[model samples]
Target: MTPPTGRPLPFPSGASPLPIPSPPALPPHPPLPPGAGGPGARGPGGAGSTGPAPGWRGLPARLARRLNRVPLRARLAALTAAAVALAVAACAVAAWFIVRDQLNERLDESLATYDISPRQLQNQLTACSGGVEVPSPPSPVTVQIVTAEGDSCVGANMIPVRVTDSDLTVAAEGPRAELGPYTPEPGEFRQGTSADGTETMRVLVRPLGGGGALLIAQSTASMEAALDNLVRLLALAAGAGAGVAAVLGLLVARGALAPVHRLTGAIEYLTRTGDLRTRVPVEGDDEVARLSRSFNAMTTALDASRARERDLVADAGHELRTPLTSLRANVDLLLRSERTGRTLPTEQRVRLLDQVKEQLVEMSTLVGDLLELSRPEGERHSTPVKVVPLHSTVEQAVRRARLRGSGITIDTDLGHWYVRSDPAMLERAVLNLLDNAVKFSPPGGRVEVRLRHGELTVRDHGIGIDPADAPHVFERFWRSPSARGLPGSGLGLSIVAQVVRDAGGTVALAPADDGGGGTVATVRLPGWATGGDADAATATGATGVSGAPGLPRATGVPGVLGVPGVPGGERDRRVPDGPVTPIRAVTPARPPQPARRPGPADGRGEGTGDGAAEEPPRS
Candidate 1:
């Protein structure tokens, strides 16, 4: 059932036929008319009518691809060698021409000086009449006389030059006034072959008396041999120069590309080994140096990111284990009781269930915090930044703290302050700070929360932090040694720090001043002086038109928390067990000082001026 060439096999009746395989077909072109092909006429699809259309449009692309196949070092070396060879060749040609012109000028001057008087020639002719042979005038010089009758004379033992029409014309015309043909000039010369045709001569003609001319011929064989020797020497020198230039070019290219090779090797090693700590060495401040610096910076960033990820995973696992273990234990206890067929007492059973529920809630909170902190700085919940009232935010946080800390008295002193930040995140940060204060406060103790301008401070009247443990409070999953028994995942302060930083502010912790027996957590955020509507309002002065709702009119007192009844001379409405500490009405203090930077007395998150995260302890 095999198919024939270029055809499909026949199928039986009611049987499916197999499809034949073929190469892709090009679009059909219109038929070309015979004998219409001519210049500027296009074929089908605008292609040429030649045997096969040329691919000139892709010529540059093809050349680029071919060039890319060559090693960069070899290309650089070859190019340098070619440039040097061109320059050297140009200089060699110029030198050869200069030498040739100088030699020709010297030879012409020497030939012009060789002249013989008619008397000397007559004496030589008379002596030779006795059959006495005379030697030639000189080895390469021939003396000949040309007369008006187109005849020639030669020195003894020298062949006479065959007279030509040029010689007869020169003799008839006499010497030219402008140093024409028969006139001998310093630089004028002519070249002709001797009658014997065995040698070429450079002839100079000098006129004699009675329409006669003397032709002195000098052989040019020696001059031509010298020029040929010079040409050979120049070619040798040029070749040697080209070879030396190639060697030097190769050496220079290698030296120049050494750093690039090192960089390539380092990057390859890093890729193969999955190592982020590798760095390329930098030497000079050139372009390569800048590239090296950038590469080092990239690797450093990768290493830091990897370390952060590792820390997050480890901390998350550690925090999750406790709650999970508690849940499992409680579940096992209930299962055992059921298996034994013993009905546990109602109170004990209720306690076990409650414990399980608490563990579940704790685990859920831990997971949420982990997810929140895992995102990079820009990816926190996409809460839009807006002008928010800081005073109202603090008041709201205080109310929440009051609910959480039942026995503790919370005091608040806030001045009208506004800031541009994500209101939701800012409130969360404030709540965390207040909750932290309430948590650490002793039963029936007072917690002071104050905000003026953009600075906010939360102080608790509990056991303050030890000097040794104050440095790890804001680190992920870091718990104080004394507070390990507390029910916290140790992520609250970390969240607070991150939120404040995202809002372009800083947070720091220190022991309360004047031996106060508690820690003070201060957050400084950049803010507008007024409630964002009135820019002219001072810190102590209140502008009530656009303030947060449900607040009493600000009284004459400066720096007082504008809560109801507290201002306008009313008694404190809601008092707890501790002393009624009146919220300080701060007099117009020098425009709220800029955020205090961390120094020897301050415990910052990252322990640096830039306020990166640090491992400070929490109380």
Candidate 2:
């Protein structure tokens, strides 16, 4: 399920036809139940019994709520339309109000024209001494004015419309002869809406000389009709604009999210192939651009991981084939001897079996080491780094080294120093170094292995790596020319380097210090970074990007002897010839990581069986 986006709804509908949100409920005010003053009187959940409370609950309610997660594009389209609609409505309303007010002002001016300008009204009031300046009198307006209750008043024809009265009250006060009813100011604009429709009339009333009022307003029916028509036209225009805006918003949404669709397709392709070589075209700078950048980074990382995996498997297969071939050959030879006419004596058979057993043991150990390295780094034995006595670990490894090569003599000076390392891995690292030293030393040659100030040096008295071979000396499957006749996988030194480096140590191979006779492998482990005590530390993920062709392709030939095609997998093929030449062969190193601290987020899992049986090489 996708996570939630915390955005407020603009025009929510709680089952309303218009889709406008209902007004917010007024918050509760403090009061209490009748006859209650304490907490116990409160309703359950601290709510008071009043109108039906609102909220969602149960299945139907939740499903209704889920309508809220509609794709953002669609939601945004809806919101845009809503905003445009509101804007247009507001504009139409404002235009109608402005036009209506303008029409009203014009109608008022017409009425005033009929009644009198200050000068005309003044002339007429004083016109009693002049002739009829307004001959035959002007048309009537809604003339109204305040008057003395029983005073006489008049309009133009003859000073005779009774005392002036309010325009609204005049007809109701009495017949056309009543003295007075309503109060109407003479100079003020007299305006009134008609009873039946928007039709109206106006008349001017001016008292010749009396306590009365004068008022006037004209029939404004045409102006009212014009304003109504204008309002309807404005509404139509506003609606048209809203429709156009909606269509444009939809088009914009579709265009803006086009890259998102491309991104989705790219991710699907990579997911299927486990390849990250494809580049997402960089576009204009925006949030989407940043997303593209992040995706590109992820793909690059995956691609690198895939390449490393391919290399690891190829290298591993190259390394494992030798020991396995030797083991198979040695076993077959023992069985063949048994099949011969002479029944092997127990002593001889025992010797052959013993050799088989020893080889088997070595194979088992190598397989175990391979498995350790191949498992996800999460599974690698982890221990907090702490101070550990270096002398004990060196002494133990040296002892094992001496036992591994009965014909090689070793010399060593064990010295005390502290280091931060997992004891078991450190010991294994030291052992691998010593074993490599013995292999390089000629039979009966003296090999020197010493430990001092946390640095262990293993020098041999045999042919060393050529200068040209030094660069890849520590890489997986890399065997040197001088070691062509050796009997071992070229994995020993590589494992040593990884272990040492992982423990914050360094390993390098160079000409020996004394007379520069053989390769001297030196491991410099970090002194303890903390004061905690050291304890025994005990020590592969997604599929390979592509296969390394585990089995050789069929040539379509029927029978081929001594040419069995072996599946290609991970193993170093170039076998180390005696123990002297130290060929470093590694398992795949991890891919680069971000600023992220290590975690189990990689979906790593444990493996079964000797992970070393990853298939052997055919070449």
* Highest lDDT model number: 1
Please give the CA lDDT of all the candidate structures. 0.62, 0.52
TM-score of 1: 0.65
Error of 2 at 18 (Å): 58
lDDT of 1 by residue, 1-619 (tens): 2221222211112222222212222346898776456555566534455543476667889988998998788788777777777887888789878987887777667666655554556534433333343444444677775655554545655544545556656655655222223335653367766676667777766655344556677777888898889888877887787778878888888888888998988899999998999999899999988898999999999999899779878867877888889899999989999999897899999999988887776777667667766776445534445567889888887886788679999998898777556676677678778777777666799999888656788887666655444556777777664565555667888778777766545576666654555767777654455653323233334322123221112233212222222456541233222211222211121122223233343222211111111111111
- lDDT value, residue 551 of candidate 2: 11
- The candidate that wins on TM-score is 1
RMSD of 1: 22.9
For candidate 2, which ten residues in a row score worst on lDDT?
536-545
lDDT of 2 by residue, 79-147 (tens): 778789899899888888888777766665565454334444433332332234455455534333323
- Residue 456, model 2: lDDT of 70
